[model samples]
Target chain A: MMQQEEKLRVSTEQLEGGLGLVAAAGYINNEGGQAIADAVNELVASGCRTILIDLEGTRIINSIGISILLEILDRLMESGGTMAFCNLTPTIARTFEIMGLVQYARIFPDRAAALAALGRDG
Target chain B: MEVALTLPLVPDVELIAARAVQVMGRSLGMTDGELESVTVATVEACLNAMEHGGQTCFFVRVNTHREDGGPSLEVEIEDHGVGFDPQAPPRTSPSRILGCVAKRGWGLTLIRELMDEVDVRSRPGKTVVRMVKHVGGA
Candidate 1:
């Protein structure tokens, strides 16, 4: 029997000007949520104050996943840093609004828009 | 056709149940938006069962039927956990939900908002959430 593959993956990149990008793919459940939280923690520890999470590859996010995202947001706000989300699906976007995550975090249509809003030219 | 699944009270298992429901809804010709609503509601229900139902495993039942007016889907999630008042007011309001900085307690609200009809019954050692979504405006 084949083992069930984990559904979430997280990868990070250090952009210029102290910006950090954390890209996630697959469902944002317990496993995926923890991966994202761990990635953001590592980036913040390395002095990446401005972080952008690209969620184009992600689709479904449950309440537990939302909680994990909120943890990351709280941490960023505490350190005077900022976080943004890009490429959200319509369902996830509405979920964010209903959960009031949009109140604190910025959302862009795509990674380029988020990067631009973060004061990057490209 | 009706299908029932028993899964462990774990977060990842919730995803598996939700995906199965989504596939069933799609096969019954549910629209994307309707399917999404059902999927979200199912996930929320499963999460509640895991957190509050106090049992190691839960059950989910998905059934499709044609009402007099149209086709519909009904999903039932049950857990053998310590149950609470199903009619209790949401812990947070929209205002507080927007202003407050916490990321919890939105599961019930989302379940009520997304599904067309929701019925919850709870007592000690048993909690069940039943939600219905009418397909294609039915």
Candidate 2:
């Protein structure tokens, strides 16, 4: 796992046929968000069309972080790529709903379900 | 007990306030979920101040409260800067078209959603956001 910041870390797994996974741990704050954004951009540049962020080890996400995620999603959608998330805390899930992010990003219960959804995208 | 924090307006400094909320909420016997809610809400409130408020630093006050129904934790974030109308329409949150949220303006929304009671008072030079969360099992 590459440490994004003192309180956050991110690691990526690339699959066959333009699929990728970025599992993150710790707080998704400003530094963490930008780190994830850079990782996603790199994956997309490497020909990933569907990406799933596994947040099983993460539970805290701020609105600024969500806003950064929104920017990533918009850029991905523009390029014919997409993003999804799995294992979000209930509070984060509720906040996502409150922020209207769930409308665009498909959140699943686990990596399996998220992959199933992203597999359809690929 | 009350814990008051003066935070520098820097990137990721909001985490300090979030961590403080965790410590305070846990002392109040709040659940993990409740703690998480307040943590996120506190971060949002702080980020809003840092981003929009014209201040070098801000203040966050955490205190315990007893409501008619149960115990609660109250968080107040104060910023001395340009204030805004809380009742104004979302300046650029889009039209809820299942797309972008204008890349901003969701901080206050998230704070309100996670906290049980939220009150905001702002003027040209000052803004205060006070939010309360019940400990649950009332």
lDDT of each: 0.81, 0.83
lDDT of 1 by residue, B1-138 (tens): 898999886546787778878888997899877887788779888888888877679999999988798888899999998898877777343454322556667788888878888898989988889988889863
What is the per-residue lDDT of model 2 for residues B40-124, given as tens digits with 9 covering 90 to 100?
8898899888977898999999998776887889999999999989997543334553363566677877777788989999998
Clashing residue pairs in candidate 1, if any? Answer: B53-B81, B54-B81
Candidate 2: segments with Cα more than 4 A from true spot: A1-6, B90-101
Best prediction by lDDT: 2
Q: In model 1, where do residues sit more than 4 Å from their true spots?
A: A1-6, A120-122, B91-103
Fnat: each model in turn = 0.33, 0.50
**lDDT (tens digit, per residue) of candidate 1 on A1-122:** 11243377789998877788999987787668889989998998898988899997776778778878877787788788888999988778878887777878899999888988797632
Name the weakest run of 10 consecutive residues (lDDT summed) in model 1 chain A: A1-10
User: What is the docking quality class of candidate 1?
Assistant: acceptable
